[model samples]
Target: MLKQAGANAWFHKGDLRRAQAWYAEALAGMRAHPEFGMEMWKVYKDLGDVFRRKGDNRRAEEMYEAAIQSAYDYYKPFKNRELAKLNCQLGTYALESGDLDRALAFFQEAMIQVFPEFNNADPAANPAPAEVYTESWIMDACAGKGRTLHARYLRTGGEADLTNAARCFDLAIEGVRQLKQSLGNDAAKIYLGDFSHAFFEEAIAVNFLLWEKRKDPVFIEKIFELMEGSKSSTLQNALQLNRAVIFAGVDKDLLRREEFLRVSMAEYQKRVQEERMKGETKDTSQILVYRKKIGDLEREYDQLLQKIGEEDPRFKSAMREVAPVALSDFRHQILGKTDRVLEFFMGKNNLYILSFDRQHADVRALPLASGVYNELFEWLARFQKPEAMNADYADFLQTGHLLFKQLFGDLAFPSDRPLKLLVIPDGIAAILPFEALNLTPPGAPPVFLIERAELRMAYSASVLTQQENWPVKTKEWVHFAPEFRTGVRGLSPLLYSARETEGVYGMTTFSGRSATLPAFLEWAPRCAWIHLSTHARSGGNGVAPHVEFYDSTLYLPGIYALRLSAEMVILSTCESGLGTIEKGEGVMSLARGFSYAGAKSLISSLWEVNEFSTAGIFSGFYQYLKKGKTRAEALRLAKLDYLHSPDRPAFEKTPWYWAGFMLIGVDGPVRHQSPVRAGFYGLCLVLAGVAWVIWRRRRSAGHSSLRRA
Candidate 1:
């Protein structure tokens, strides 16, 4: 056991040589002893950890699996507290192995032992709410199980998985509070604090994923309070990234990603060398992570090579892969993403994209829910490698570039040359610390980086408001060509512009002559991509009219106000995702209106989107539209762009300030064809609703006159 522990310490410090020696000794000792004890488990765990560190996850998984089995056999009969800890470790390990069912089983087993001692009831069947539920241990089980359930939902989309995730989180919360009270040593319990924090974070993430990949600030509001009213960088980064993807906007996060520059390339190499010399190999728990953590170094090396090769353009390579998004003839629909086709690549091939422009230096990892598969990534590399080797590489690269630009449209080519990233939320917009990979790595595709920072927009705004101005900040003479520029007008009383009548639902025929569909509302019949509504924001406050018809009546904070049909509708409203709640009823809001109306999901504001920042946000928002990004991913990206910018005090704030915009109920990998009816009914609904608007206007006039008299 001591030898195994020594090995792990070595591995953790990045001294693979010493670690291997230690493991070899432990392995021999374990084999000779053949005992059912700590020595055996330690040997297996340490061995696996080392292999995984060396980029051998497959072998590591096999070893870990054996360790888990033996540990369980050794501990099952004793029901010891330490056994519970091992169970947690096993559960986490299984998840890393991509064996979700097995992972869930381990977590459940842990929870079973925990229930009576901590929860006072069996959580396997149902969550038992009670004042007696104490022992932070049980609460921890609930959270662990909840995490498993949430991940299962991502993998399978089973309603049971989602519901259980919610239930477990709720139970965990109840148990945590009760435990704190019973223990009478609240502050001293670091375990309780850590458990509470992790559970809360996981719960909020799960809820947001369930409700449609948009972080529900409602859950976060409570979680943030529970953990000593302080903030965790983990939570902040998760949230900021979430906002970025959902919004497709920009901010300091993009430019500050340049912080990777501060990370010395030599320093990275030096650290690797130091680890080797110290006889330790840093264990990232898994080889995948270990490699990814240092992906920048390899990328840097490749870029150096590419920069040298640039002397002769023909000597340079062209690597291209088609359909990372899977917009091929075959169809697999998830979320509402099946409607469009496009992609983005991080390489120096200089794809022809002749039809349009397509290159972004700022890239972030997509969460597990994004419609990309692990296998697909490897497949992409395999395909591109061969493509790069073709005699037609240059021709195909040019043609492919042109085709990509044409297919993706203006969004792909925001400019003819280098893209001018607009900083939002506000900071300098630089390329994502990256250079094309010169070679296809065994795992993820390689790329070089200059710097990486959890991007935050360093914008300038004394106060938040409804209008956003995005004038050209670059000396490069960039301008939105009028024909290519889009002018959108949004109107919905449930949003930022009309809070006095927050829950009110009415009609409008303001488009002129309701007998026939008005020109404004009739556009859906033509070939179009989006249905945007700049409306009011309601919900979040939990105060509303109690009107069943409008979920806004429930008045939860940070939801959109308007619901449009079967197309992509920018609620352009605020806090509509948050629903009004009655004493015993679940929350409801306009999100449902659009869901029922056949709309994919509403891109809405959680809080009021700063009006002054709208134009800039719209730019990225439109880019996503052009790129054919799914509603959710697009909005998330836009929000991220806004939060990471540094142009102004307000321009580069978090989603909380303005990037809280969310796309409700619309995330899947490959976008599907916007249902054909989207063309007809989408336009029809706007036209029909206009009359309702007029009627409401008339009634308002009458009420005003009566009050005056």
Candidate 2:
């Protein structure tokens, strides 16, 4: 038999493509040799890596799954590390496709089969103490999944999404720390990758979270530890210059510009004064020169001369050297903080929130709830000045039709028609006076804007007592269309004295999910940008289940975690985002489940989403999008307005109502199609009419000729 040593040598030599190909060939040749079960499984893993590199997710998942289920198992005592890795991928797809329950099930099932080692703050806390896992493998899963989850959290804004991410980071740090303590003696090399990447990623993730949470710079300081040994790259430069920006927040108490100037100048002055001390006495001319230098130094220390924001040249200089790791880190930084929660008011970046209605007089934290409006403007202002991400910001802004186009492209700002944002009840617009506000669509005018409003039912119809304040007494809410379209409609009536009006389209469906109503079965349609399912959810369980459909689905008939389906799904019913259901079963709630689902995002209700607030939040969200604001921008504005209601300020200010709605599709394109394709047959009718007329003329001429003969 061929020696394992030779095969491993090739793999270690960085000949991945060659090694992978060799492994493939060897496995194919050894297929008849059933005794080489474990070897065959290794080859399959190699193939999975190769396929993954080639951008074939399907093929890679297939190979990995096969290895875990069969080939590796067929061998003597297969490794749990490899199996766990494959299951993670499988769970990703299910999560993305709106089956959050399924996704969790897959992950839990995979973890059970794999006997994974816990590499957290306590390496000794492995659930599977009987069969230990290597640190290398744990790190492998942690690093890869943590990075992916961080991105996911920003897009979706689901607390559950970040839960495991925190776990992974802790495990990574602990695993590494433990390994450092037990190097060579213990089998911890397997987790080296996780150890290497976790600290930095976690620091960035936490910083971004804090910025979103408190909008303070102190949280950013927490990341300095990661730059302890790293060089000045994009991430490093971002971190380096961040000190100035962070200082601005606390600057009220701590002279920010002065501190920077003093520190930088102090170091220079100290060096100069030291040199002067060493040198011998010079001529009067030298004394004059030193006096002139003193004048320059004094001028440099003046705070007035230094630019207040991005105009500071020191920032530019500090960041000129773009570090690759730093750049990647910065990217993560931006990705982590962005939110779709404020999608209710797609206001101008410079536009301030103003409720002329007087009812919102109770508003106080209006500024805080305004989402990213202030932040985006700050960044926009900074972009005008020197910064490495100036180009990146420029590109993003330019991507928009109006402002962005003015800076970058020929595209115009999005039409007045709402941006087609699926507003969730989780936003501030929900708290608005729905009746007072004009929830009507756009009228034909200078701004060709039309807002399509759709409400997401996060909770199921079964248990809605949680929202006792919301009395569903009005038929107007249930009636999506007018009552006139009650029965079957065969024809349209004439505008003058007509018997009936336009009826509801048949394509639209309004039916209960099922009789049993499984507690959770996330079913987000790929075509819909927003999904609304109503169901009760709780977070009191050891096993994390992000989402579920109904009560029955928990553990009885279906037993699934609520999964997500679209960019945003409004869990209007209950605490859908709560981390309920047992771990391994999946997210008992639907929000987290859908984040894993393909929809790319979700918006969930809290303890009990106020029906009035929920309605207003969604109405304004769609209306804002109609005005062409990004999801994050709109949600932010709406939240700001809700925060204006002074009664709820001190305790409830975290734009959770506004920011809770996440953008899952941030990484992917909105899967959609134009009307041209949906109505292809309508165009074909013209061709058919033309053909029929031509045939009639030919037949008439032929008959006339025969009659004449």
Candidate 3:
């Protein structure tokens, strides 16, 4: 027990070498004691984890297999979650190693352990019971089998293999939905959704392949459904829940109960977190107690929410599982006549671009060139180092043009005017600055892609279409600019932010000592637009990404707790748009946190931005917003204005200064004035005009009569 504890301590501290040695010693000690036989599987699993983390894939697989063997040999009933987990691990190993038959066998065994009556011969014919679908192991097993079958289809070009793969993926995706529904908290749901991203990717890939082979619209429809169902789903759910509480007219008592339970759960979670952070000296018993309390609270919360949903049909609809909008409906209802959407899905070796408009839907597959990913990373690195970009301008320009050709050259666009393009990026494509790509001929003067298209991004097509109808706040703008001159928490003072905030008209400003996290939280929800000019740190060194305010830091999890109704959030901070990339879920950035908090649109920076340039650009951005320009157009024009400014040095005109910021989600005007309000204002203006005209006519008549006399 002591040896195992030592192993865990080392593992938690990220000393994998020492952890591996300790685990080995522990395993050897356990093998000598017959009473410890049943517990041997745990040590082996730990060893597997250690090996996996150390990048010893071969050793990791062997350890995982040994864990399964130990479980079967000593455990009374081998059909258990632990055994299922070991088998799934082995299955993933085999799949990655290209041993499809072995991978499928291991996955089948995993399913059998979970269901006990699971038939590998006909998995689709006898699906796991709905209640059992909440076991994430079953979902992983199904995804593994589906991926193995897809691999087989790729090798043999068999339609049967493809069809079976699609079916398995469908079952796996359904399991994902059930699992998410079973969770009581958004954090847990987001974790599960992020973990299950690969399943969605495989599902989309297989269905897209099936569509290519069959040429059926149903397969295409399924592809769109999967895309919408997977991408940024947690953000969508949070928005929906807010809508349910606010607009669905849910009972106040029920809402209060739900809030209490959530808060209680959060307290318990915090306790557990604090205990775990004690490292080698942590109190296991206290941690377990806190976990149990959290679990109890979660169950109670789930029950209360279920009751509320049952009592209110609108709540049920709002909180219900995500359903895919039909392709026809998406095209006709969601897309405008001039709008075009390019949704990219990056598979292991192929990139699929689904392009659609109100009149057309087409999918194109591009086989990736060798080392293309490395090239992309290298290209992005140049943006951070302006010296490198300036040093090799020719190389940079050539590479940029080549990337443009690879990504967009094949697409046909209308030549009448610039395209209103909505981009849905996946994988590494999320960080890509599409606007920075050179679109001109190699020898011709540089013309950027942004010049040819007014571009904005969406998490998914469904998210884009499902616009939340939060009540408009009376206050138009709220700005925060925190001075970090003390250098607390490694943040530097933003010299230009205070001036920048002052430049904006009709905004409630919080600066220096007053720009605290608590103050922002209290007033942010009451405003239609939020602008935060502060320092932000991206996630690293076991710390979550956060924005540093005057008083304290607000982490990503803290951001999730906020209930906001702002139409736009401008994060004029460094790397506010950067975070840990969670496959299908997009970047877990501060910008995404605002989205989860119900902000309709966001303008955030991808990298550490030039504070001076950011201030100038955003000043123009607000002015354009006041002119009622769309968010995407306003951002584009703001960057353009910066580029055209003769006062700026030529060296600063590079994309490194201006291309870091992106506009995400809805691209509508900053404040959408209600039609009724607009009509009333119009009536008042007309009445005032008539009164003036009548007065002018009476004066002219009086003057004419006097002249006649």
Candidate 4:
């Protein structure tokens, strides 16, 4: 126990060397204390964690195997929660090492060990957890099996892989929901931590894979439902500040106390900051005191919220009220002339695209993995950089031509009408600049795909569906262009932001201001549209994206605090739309963040932009919008305007200048209905009502005559 405990302490503190030494000592101790019972098993499991942290996977495998043997030795049946936990750990190891079949077997065995009666009876009959629902080991096991199956599917294109993957994820989700229900209000007392987040992400992802493979809009609808499930599980209000509030039936005093703790936490943070800034004080005692105060307040606040939820069911009902949009409703609302949509759904082994017009929809698969897509994306990302524009153009053009042919060549293009493409990029494809793809022959003058067709982009087809009926109120626009004082360097000033704002101000009723956090939070939600012309700092490898303002930054985690219903949000900053790409979670970009915050349309840059050229494109986009063009069409016309402008330079004509921005979300004519159509609908309804009354009266008169005879 001593050695195992020491190893866990060191591992959590990130001291890998000390952790390894303690784990080694624990292994020796386990041999000496052969009769140590379940404690011996824990030592083996802890050792495995230590080895995994050290990247010695072979040793980790041996440790996991020892843990399983210890579990068998202790329990007669060897079908306990401890055994399940050990098996799940092994499954995780195998999955990480790329042994898909082995991982799936281990996960399946673990699931059976935890819920042996799962196959015999309905899931509702076994609502209670084998150990405790809060442990989440079973959830992890199911998610692991689903992920491994999906991986194998990518390799073999097996329909069974998808079927089993979907089943495993569904079981896990149902189990969670059932457990929550069985617990009732007591469910609020349990916090499963980040495992629940990962579970839902995997669940949504597996269904997305099914949707991509099957091309059934029903699968997409399932995705929407799963997303709603994810949101419903979140106890804090997304629209308001990240705080838990008492529902109608709950005691208001609970909320009042919770609010007080939040205020106290904020005060402690402010005091800590003030103490740190006082350089004269080499004594940081006050900062430590304030930090402890903040921690205490946070714990108290959490407890208060939990109590409120346990006291009333209305809290949960209020949280679950916001559901995801339906697919059928979205399909029926698809109204546009040249609007063609291409939705990319990336699986572990392949990429899928569903292309559709107002009248037709079809699905196609791209036989490319994340590795291949990354290679092509890296090339495109490089080509879009300002410094790379002057380098050898042949390789860039060749790569462009290759990608263009691969992505669009198989799809049937409309022969009669002009094509306005709305590209919904997925996974690595989020970083791809689709408009830059070359459609010209090798060695011919560069002719970009944007020139051949109108192109816009989207976060997801479901997001577009959600925005189908969003009314564009055409209110005043809010523009932001803040100057940097620190943490940003080695870049020329965006003088064009001022020029761009000036042009926009003249065209419409607009309010332009410095991009400060306070000002942004105040103005963003009130306007119909927002355009930020500041800087953005995007993180790689599964980190949240953020936009840097004058005094502070807005991160993905905090974006939900904003209650925005803006028609559009334009992020004119560098890579503002790029985010951490996770296999099952999709891209966590600023564009997605804005969409989640209730923006109907978004314009984001996949890469950095040329300030002057971006200014011109912005002007043209607004001009087209004012003239009643669809959001997608307006962006296309803007890019074309930039490409063909008489005052533009040769470099400006390249896709690098005009293709950085992409429109994502809704795509259709802005002003489709008028007063005449409204009046006609009213008249038709009146006539139908009159005809119904006449038919009912005639039927009644016939019955009366029959009775008289």
Q: Which 10 consecutive residues of model 3 have the lowest summed lDDT? A: 671-680
Which pairs, if any, clash in model 4? none
Q: TM-score of each candidate?
A: 0.31, 0.28, 0.77, 0.68
Q: Which wins on lDDT, candidate 2 or candidate 4? A: 4
Deviating ranges (above 4 Å) for candidate 3: 1-132, 250-317, 347-349, 365-369, 468-475, 483-495, 498-505, 674-709
Per-candidate count of clashing residue pairs (backbone under 3 Å): 148, 115, 0, 0
Question: After TM-score superposition, what is the CA distance of residue 653 in candidate 4 from its true location, in Å?
Answer: 0.6
State the lDDT at 340 in candidate 1.
Answer: 22
Report the number of the highest-lDDT candidate. Answer: 3
Assess the local accuracy of residue 385 in candidate 4 as a C-alpha lDDT between 0 and 100.
67
lDDT (Cα, tens digit) per residue for candidate 4, span 1-709: 6877888899899998998888778778777877666677777787787788788888888887888888888985646877778778788888888988788778877777777564322211222343325335667667777778878888898878877777777667665655554332212413432235556656566666777667777675566455434432322123222212412445767756765675566456545544544567634887777767766766776677567667866765554433444545545554343366565665545565556665665555566653457657556766556568547567778777878777786554456744667676666777788878887779898777776677766554444554654544446567777644333443345666655545343223222235677888777766676878777756553234677666665666456445566777888888877776644334557776677666777888877777778878887876676566777778888888888888977765777888788877666553433222333456778899999999999999999999999
Q: Is candidate 1 or candidate 4 better by TM-score?
A: 4
Model 3: lDDT equals 0.78
Better of 1 and 2 by TM-score: 1
Local distance difference test, candidate 4: 0.65
The lDDT per prediction is: 0.40, 0.38, 0.78, 0.65
The predicted structure with the larger lDDT, 1 or 3, is 3
Full candidate order by lDDT, most accurate first: 3, 4, 1, 2
Q: What is the lDDT of residue 254 in candidate 1?
A: 36
Instruction: Report how far residue 655 has shifted in candidate 4, in Å.
Output: 1.0
Ranking by TM-score: 3, 4, 1, 2
